[model samples]
Target: MCLFTETRIKFRLFEGCAAESGTDGEVVLGVEAGTYQVFALPDHGSAYGAQWVGLTGGTGSQDLARNVVVAAGEQKDIHKIFMDRKGTVTGVVTGADGAPVTGGTVAAVTPVIGDAGRGRVAIDTQGRYTIDFLGPYAWPLSFQTSTHAFQWSGAAHRRQSATLVPVTAGQTTTFDQQLALGTLVKVTATGSPSGRYAVAYNNSNGDVAGFIWVQQAGGQAIFRVMGGQQVKLQFAGGEPGQGWYGGTDFDSAKTVSIPATGEKVVVYPYS
Candidate 1:
């Protein structure tokens, strides 16, 4: 409960002189994701080299630097250690020559996340792009637009936002997209037969229930029971979790594989 024990953590970004030079800029530091205490002296050729890292593991004390301590009541910016250990700022990527480039590479220089989490996405025909992942590692990404390339290190963060970068999920981000591009697939019931059916969709995991249509869009629609095994297409009309037919509480859900790129199957149900 003593204010004297209050620890101040500071972080510094190693950016580039992209203003003058046109090379791939670099940002380097030693602070981990959390916080730390520090003393900044003039550069000594090497970074805060060999400094004692007393990080305790949690987001609070994981990357605490040793040998230096900020006085109580006085907070110092020790950001010199934890760089892009945050999120990301991405939209469209262009070339130095001001022309659109395709397949231009984007590498996370400071992995706010981890190596496996290093994000890389292809620039579309329109030069629009999105970061795959950005975590706690302040790894500034290196972008190449034709002969022109730059790094976000030296460049001041564009938006004066919460000062904290947040991660964007869903690796399947759309490129060159303005609106939500919904995909459409066609389904044919054929002589499918009448029944109670449940439809499932694919996601990062395996298969999950998306929408459970009773019949085809227009056939006899009714709430149907769903099971864990395969999606059931019970022929008998019944409420969800009830017997669609006889001994069969709900007819057996046909255990089958749903194609990834084609249309989902739709079964018809009788009244």
Candidate 2:
């Protein structure tokens, strides 16, 4: 199993600037002149974990990263980052019919500074999966299979509603998932510009059910939502700019009610 671990490091330069260091152990990044916090994250499944420039033990927190001031056209060398060994999570994936799911993926998401630390692994033929090299923290797990809708660890659809699994270094945690059927929602956007648009379905709790990109104006995109769930549709990056369906903003947007599986909902033009 150790051979399957990925040995790459991701260097984050504060905000959104990032660079990847491969097996050669070298990385170069160009950024604007400013004060930035530098941190490195080892790829998921690696025995090593994430850490700041000067911090060891793989705390995986950006607050611990050292602050460095860089002037325009000035080159600075960040010290080597040291990481500690991480934990592992293993489980079995089963379908709604109580049978083991043959093929799929399980992902663990950890909330961190700037961006979340994520690790994903494929389920084997026996429906077993092991996510290695996760920092010691409470993580939300997401399961996806070709025949079932994506679901969180507690069989919840939203991240906020899912269960948080605890992980500890030098130990293994067990987490299992059972999937449920999802409702299919088809949205049609008309009277918009002839460009790609992203349609997102957000629930009342501000949790996104799913999103898809429409290739052209008047085109349609489909995504899955929970059955009998009420959600609001938000459109972005198209002719009329970003806005919610039935209204210009989130507060005024009309709520869409999803029917059962095999049913479809068509969203008309944005007013």
Tell me the tens digit of each residue's lDDT in model 2 across 1-271.
Answer: 1111111122212223256776767777666787766545566447775443433433433334466677899998866655567778898888889888999677653212222234457899989999876667666677766576566788776555668777788899998877776777778767655554444444545544555556676677676666656777865663343546787765677788777568667767854
Candidate 1: deviation at residue 81, Å?
Answer: 18
> What is the lDDT for 189 in model 1?
32
lDDT of 1 by residue, 174-240 (tens): 2221121111222333333445343332211122222234445334432211212233333323444
Candidate 2's displacement at residue 40, Å, is: 7.0
Q: What C-alpha lDDT does candidate 2 achieve relative to the native structure? A: 0.61
Please, what is the whole-model Cα lDDT of each candidate in the order they appear? 0.31, 0.61
TM-score of each: 0.24, 0.59
lDDT measured at residue 59 in model 2 versus the true structure, 0 to 100: 41
